[model samples]
Target: MKAWFARDYGRPDVLRLEEVAKPVPKPGEILVKVHATTVNSGDRRIRACDLPPGMKTLGRLALGWSRPRQPVLGTELSGVVEAVGQGVTRFSPGEAVYAFPGGRMGAHAEYVLLKETGPVAHLPEGVDMQTGAALCFGGTTALTFLRRGAVRAGQSMLVLGGAGAVGSAMVQLGKLAGAHVAATTSAGNLDLVRAHGADTVIDYQKTDIARLAERFEVIADTVEAMDFATAQKLLTPNGRYLAIAGTLKEMLGSLRKGPEGKRMIAGPADERIEDIVELGRLAALGQYRPHIDKIYAFTDMPAAHAHVDTGRKRGSVVVQVAQ
Candidate 1:
């Protein structure tokens, strides 16, 4: 099997493509022949050790002391089950599936193994592998935060960095909930975000998000560009600030302040099979879709990482791993 190994935490250059032994399924695990995967912000952050302030030691401890604890650097994937370990009755050898490997992060290769009980679901009919690979990172993240914010119909929600993976998901999910969605991104992505269902779009480079007159019932910062102070001011009374890409200061502050009026909420998205299943159903029904920015060949993993590092992608950056 071929895999991109992160030799050490640095630039995209550190990711070296090499022939590695294919992973085998353990009991209760299924081995998948990967068809597609993605280069998410989380992958870029981890590969480059882009830690927030006051979190270097903690990040080092959690990720690795000197290097990445997990050498492979991908989170979500769409693949076909090639084999299933003993006792794995839910999946067979030929099932089409997509999964979020979550904290394990081993989807950047031709083959990946996961327990059947993990965040793995059958790819719904009419959902292609490319779309399937793009959903988990954005869908699960946006859905988790929106649910936490208790977003409802007839309310106004603002999505910061609405062109990125999680932000695009926020725009679509907010609209599906019947909320009036406002989004901010680069001027080039305004139409893209709008297509995803944002009723109002703002170009962050041209306009100041803080100076906007309208307030929102839920303000989601998917790019971590907005601090809690500014986001709180933009929130309506009893609103919630959902920070998917928050800094360490905001995280610690949230623990101190807790969930109150215009409260701060910061955490990693929960990876659940139920969420993946729902997203698959929605994609199959054309109610939701991932906006693809680019698709690189499996061997071009380094180039894919570099593109993600540029931070200018319209939506998910996918890497086609196998046919």
Candidate 2:
């Protein structure tokens, strides 16, 4: 099996494709022949050790001190089950599946092994491998934050960096929750964000968000562009601020109560197998679709990483690992 390995953290070029021993499924696990996977912000951050301010040391301790603990640097994948281990009756060989080994990595290869009970599910019919590979990371993150904020019908919700994977998912999920959704993106992505169900789209490059008069009941910042102070002014009383990409300081602020009963929600999202199941159901119903910015060959994993590093992708950047 061929996998892209990131031995050291520096840049996209650090990734090197090499031949590695194929992994066999252990008990209660299934081995998948990967058809597609994604190079998302998580990959970029881990590959380059790009931690937010005040988090460098902690990130290093969690990830690795001098090199990555896991050389294979991918999180989600869509593939066909090639084999199933003992006692795994939930899935069979030849089934199409999507698995999110979120933070476990190792999807940037020809094959991957997933536990039968992990965050892995059948790829819904009519959803292609590319879309399946793109679904989990952003969808799960958005759903987790929305649930934490208790978003509801008729409320106004704002999504910053609305064109990125997580941001786009937030916009779509926010609308599905019946909230009046507004999003911020570059001028070129206004229509893109609107297409994802945002009722109002603001060009972040042209408009100063701090000066906007409108306030939102829930504000989800996916780009870490707005701090607690600025977001407080834009939020209605008792509103919730979702710091999806907050710095260490901002994340620690999650412990402190905001003025007037407002609150901040931060930290890593909890990945659940149920979330993957819901995303598959939504995709099958045509209610949720992951926006794919580009597709690269497996050998072009470095190029895919570079593209994601640009911070200009509208949504997911997929890599076709197999046919």
Best candidate (score: lDDT): 2
C-alpha lDDT score of every prediction, in listed order: 0.90, 0.92
Per residue, candidate 2 scores C-alpha lDDT tens digits across 1-323 of 99999999989889999998988889999999999999999999999998888999999999999999998988999999999999999999999999999999889999999999988999989999999999999999999999989999999999999999999999988999999999999989999899999999999999999889998999999998888888899989999999999878877898987898788989898798898899999988888898999999998999999999999998999999888
Which ranges in model 2 have alpha carbons more than 4 Å from their true place?
none
Q: Positional deviation of 144 in candidate 1, in angstroms? A: 0.8
* lDDT, residue 100, model 2: 95
What is the per-residue lDDT of model 1 for residues 42-72, given as tens digits with 9 covering 90 to 100? Answer: 9998999988878899999999988899999
Give the CA lDDT, 0 to 100, for residue 118 in model 1: 86
Q: On a 0 to 1 TM-score scale, where does candidate 1 land against the true structure?
A: 0.97
Backbone clashes under 3 angstroms, per model: 0, 0
Clashing pairs in 2: none
